[model samples]
Every structure is written in C-alpha cells, then in structure tokens.
Target: MSAKPWPEGTGCRILQEVDSTNAEAQRLAPTLSGPEWILAHRQTTGRGRRGRPWANPVGNFTATLVMQPGETPDKVALRSFVASLALFDAFVAATGRVALFALKWPNDVLLNGGKVAGILLESAGAGGTLSHFCIGIGVNLVAAPSRSDVDESAITPVDLQSETGARVTPEEFLDLLAPAFADWEAQFSTYGFAPIRQAWLNRAAKIGEVITARTGKESVVGTFETIDDTGALVLKTASGRRVISAAEVFF
Candidate 1:
C-alpha cells in the first residue's frame, strides 16, 4: 500500500546510533532487497554470537549488508568468508602492506595480536524457506574500547600500525568494503564457495595448530582442520570429525 521505509540500492547508509546493525536488519526484514544497508558509528546494543555483548564503539567501520532473497538459510555460512575477505581487502588497502590481516575462524579478523574486525550474519525467515541474510561487520578504525571491557583479547588497526603516520578513516575503509562486496558477491553466486574456502584457509591462523574453542556449554581443545566445502569449520576431534557452525576460537 505504502512505500516501506528502507534504503534503496547500491550504496551503504551510515548511522550515528542504533541498537545493532543485525537488529536493525531484523527490523528491515520481511521486505528487504540487496541494497546493502549498514548502520554503524555507534551501537547502543551490540551483539556477538550466542547472546554475547559485542563491544561496538563509535568511529569505526561496522555494517550489515542485507543479502538477496531465495538462498537457503544453512548455506549462508559460506557467505561469512566472503565478508571476511571484504574486510581483509580493506585492511590491506588501508595499511598498504601484505600480511596485515588474518582470520580467527568462523568470523573474527585479527591485526597484530588484537582484534580489528568481526563479521556477524543473522537470518530472518523460516529455516527451510526463502530468506534474507544480514552480514554485520565491525572494523576498528580510530579509538579502542577499554581493554578491561573486552571479554577476550582485542586490538584495532590504530593499535597496530598507527605509527605509519597516516591513519585509515571510517569513510575510506567503508569505500573499500562496498566495492569488495560487489566483487565477492559475483564470485559467490557463480562458482559456489570452493575458491573462497581455499582463500580463507590460506590466510587463516592456526589452521594446523591445536587451539581452544568455546561453544557456550563446553570448551574443548582440538586441532584446527581446514574449513569443509560446506563452510563449517572442521575440528579434528579425538573421536572423529566435528563440524562447528559457531564457536569462539582462541590460541
């Protein structure tokens, strides 16, 4: 009857305040298109997986790209690496150097010894039915939240390479990420996800090393195997192969 209040297409919308990009994405659901909307500047309500409160600060790069409809929900796990790649490109482009970015399983981006970027995807619709996915990304650009506030260790681009005498601004970072999604989205649709899976593993940290994994109820130490073709992180368990859809990994 009336126009639904949502952003149109091809550009990312910046917001100064919101509960969370993922949450806002939920609100925009039931009527979403691939306009690639983002609400990041400050999130009064931020979230990590499994109800963990993410420390989302202002003046950083945080966004939620609303994916197109009709894709199966479970398959969206494959999209996580695409988001990771987008952030990785932004990291390298900003710093103008190689090896400046790395992945920490499922979806955390690490720079130096601390965190610089995080990727979150939320679904809106029935499990087996057609659905839209919101890919939320947070990249620290300027200031850092209090170290004491971080549940686990975290770092930012500024914390690592600020000595370069030229800092990457939020605008510049977002500019890089927008075109990145455009490029990666094409690859994801045409070739499925094998290429991205390989690329992610190549840049993945501790792929062959044993690491600690926390999945809310239990914490297990296991050797990190490569990500399977299905996009689930494979851990070589003592019993056999254990595929993880979501977990907080640490070294």
Candidate 2:
C-alpha cells in the first residue's frame, strides 16, 4: 500500500509477485547502497546460509541491504551485531517491550523463545575494492512456516494476534526498522565492535550458560567465553581456548 519509494538513503524497494529477496538484492547490490536497497513481496526461493531456505510468505519483512565501506570482510564482521541491534529495536517497537527480544549468536533474532528474524551476509568480487555485497534479512511477521520450512521451531507475529488475528505488515515493520538499522549502522561505522559486543552480550541468550555447538564433524557443550576482536565465537574448551568459525548452537 505504500505508494512512493521511501525517501531514505537505502530505500530502494520494489514489488514483485514473488522473487527471492536475497537474489533480487544481490542482483541490485552493484548499484544501490545503504539500508534496504531491495525487498520482495514474496520469496519463491529465499535462502539462508548453509543452503537453508528462509521463509518469505506475504506480509513478513523480506529485505536485503548493500554494505560497502573501506574494510575487508574480516574487519566488517561487526555488521552482524549492527543488524541484530536493528531487529532488536524493531521488536521492542512492535511489542512495546524489550524483554521479548534476544540474540542467537552472529545474527538471529529470537522472540518469545522462537525465531522471528535472521540475517545472511554474502560477498561479491574480492579485496577491499569489492563490487558489492548483500545482507538478506527475513522476519516472520504475518506467518511462521511449518517445521519443514524452518530449521528451528516456528514462530509468527500472529502470536501477537493483533485483536483481529491478522498478520503484521511489512510496511509497519520497515517503518520502525529503517531508523533503528541506520542508527546501529552509524554506530558500527563510527566506532568498532567493542561497544557493540557489550550491547550484544546484554541480550545474548547463552552468555554465561552451557551451550551446544555443532561445527562440522564434532559437537560439544561449553561455556561461551566471549566474542573476540574479529567476531569469532570463542568457546572455553577443556583442552584450551577454541575459536570457532561457523557452528550451529543451541541453549
């Protein structure tokens, strides 16, 4: 129902009967910059990292952003926290309470003990002069897919059941998300990950508790030590300190 292109630095939105927002964003990243450069009405094949499919039914916010700066991939790892902070703030605005928002590592937003949103970042080109990159975001606003469509237990904005039991709109969510995302992106761009790390830990689900992590061929339970300068999830192991590159964790 939004009539005009949202007047923001990153508000390059278009309507499609259905197209994967991630793909659309990647296809457009070489051009647009900032906040939300691409968004899809319905995603036929929205994907997450590791070949997971991101649910993109109507009404949920399925968007992607183009991130470009003078940093290497390793240096810009803080983007995860920045993106999470944006969704966290959006959750607070939606429910008028911050207690329901929590982070599940790198970039997953949990609500009421269920996944409400996730972020997927990918690169293009190489080196510091990268062509462009895309950060795909999927939020379960109107409906949550069945277990078969999601890797984790399902959740829906309908859980809020807004008096009419109708779904939440993408517009309503984007209205709150854009400003919050811009704010956090500004912080991450200005400062570094140190401050964001503390903010992230404040809402992190498994900060001081034992969590299960599945890296590749092994799975272990350990206390999450901390996120180092480069954004690696450090786990204190019995043998020694182990910093993991990628893993599926549960608390």
| Top TM-score prediction, candidate number | 2
C-alpha local distance difference test of each model: 0.71, 0.71
* 15-65 per-residue lDDT for model 2 (tens digits): 664467667766766666454556677788778879876667667788777
Overall local distance difference test of candidate 1 = 0.71
Stretch of 10 with least lDDT, candidate 1: 1-10
> What is candidate 1's CA lDDT for residue 221?
76
RMSD of each: 5.6, 3.7
Residue-wise lDDT of candidate 1 within 116-234, one digit each (tens)? 77777777666486467788877667665566766643333334334333466666677777776667767888888988888888889888888877787787778898888887778
